[model samples]
Target: MAIALNTLVEEAERYLNASRIQDYCPNGLQVEGRPQVSRIVSGVTASQALLDAAVEAEADVVLVHHGYFWKGEDPRVVGMKQRRLKTLLSHDISLLAYHLPLDVHPEVGNNVQLARQLDIVVEGPLDPENPRTVGLVGSLVEPMTASDFARKVRIVLGREPLLVEGPQMIRRVGWCTGGGQSYIDQAIAAGVDLYLTGEASEQTFHSARENGISFIAAGHHATERYGIQALGDYLARRFALEHLFIDCPNPV
Candidate 1:
């Protein structure tokens, strides 16, 4: 039996606490689809290929980490936007996305997932004052060398981590999932031995050298893929819906 689109949206809204947060794009139902949803397809980004895969799979909804209508993005829906929307509308497939909300959610968030994978016990948010802060600070259950931690991250994530080694043993570590190099300062302020995130900017090299805090830039797409995968699995169990995670490799 298929669940109502409204029901699924409501579930997502509640699970993510979507209403309380300001996001880049609308959190749920960016495009309306059929009233009933039996199958869902998820991806890291709502790219053209992903949309096509969802349509082919007969998915009622396509859930993603990144959707359209970003802040300061072009409002005009002309070229890429027009095509993406057209396909969904034509097939009556809904598009639902959760950005930072998904990134920071305590249970299924990117940071927490990465922590779980790397065996880190998350104490709390890296930025204590902001609930929306995507980074987290915590200690390992058993302290290990920075190199060892980096190896664990690489093996668990199946990607080479960009490591800027600082101290001998890394007890306190701070991490954010995707493209979070900007939060290096936040991690340093939290007094962590190592800071781990997805991508790095050119300036990040300088930040590492000057701040004396170890930095790691794991692959953006690789680190981010886990959270939404967890989210999709959760939805599948809770809703008894058929869900598939579409993997599209991205080096960046």
Candidate 2:
């Protein structure tokens, strides 16, 4: 069954509580296409490659976690942005994106989904003081050594994670998906044995080593892929619309 574009957007915004959170980009429909949408193609980022894939799939809508028009980015429709917008407009494919809302969602969030995949039992928010904190602090079903935990992450994520070993055994863990390495300080304050995130900076290694907290840098693309797919599946089931996940893999 086909759903109206506005209906789908409203449903997603309501489910994600988009209006409640302040995000870098707009959280709902970024581009409008046809009034009715029957098929959706979901992905991590709405890049040109993903858009091209959506066009090839004959998708009526393209749904993603990352969309265009960040806070400080150029507003002009030129270069890469122009090309991507052109592709969507020319093909009449709607672009629906969710940023912070997708990451913090309890059930289908990137952090929660990553934890479930890695067998972590969520305890609570990493920053309990902040109600809208995107990161989470949790524990494994069973404690494992720092190296062993890294191996498990590698297996589950299908990519080798960069590990900065700390404690012998990892009991309490804190994690946030996609370039959340800066949260290591919060994790250390929480007294977690390990901290995991998608990307790491030069100082991240020093922070982990000096603080005695194990760190793991899983691939950003790999870590974030699940949440969008989960959202797509939920939408498909909820609205009875066909959904397809297109994986355009990126090492970073």
Model 2 lDDT per residue over 138-234, tens place: 9989999999999999999899999999966999999999999988898999999999999999999999999988999998998899899999999
Q: What lDDT tens digits, residue by residue, belong to model 1 across residues 1-252?
A: 688999999999999998998877788778898999889999999999999999889999999998888889888989999999999999999999999889989999988988888888999989998666778999999988888888998898788888888755888999888989998888888988888889999988788778777788988888888788899888888889999999887877
Residue 161 lDDT, candidate 2, scale 0-100: 94
Tell me model 1's lDDT, rounded to 2 decimals: 0.88
The residue ranges of model 1 lying beyond 4 angstroms of the native Cα positions read none
Model 1, poorest ten-residue lDDT window? 160-169
Clashes counted in candidate 2 amount to 0
Estimate every model's Cα lDDT from 0 to 1: 0.88, 0.93
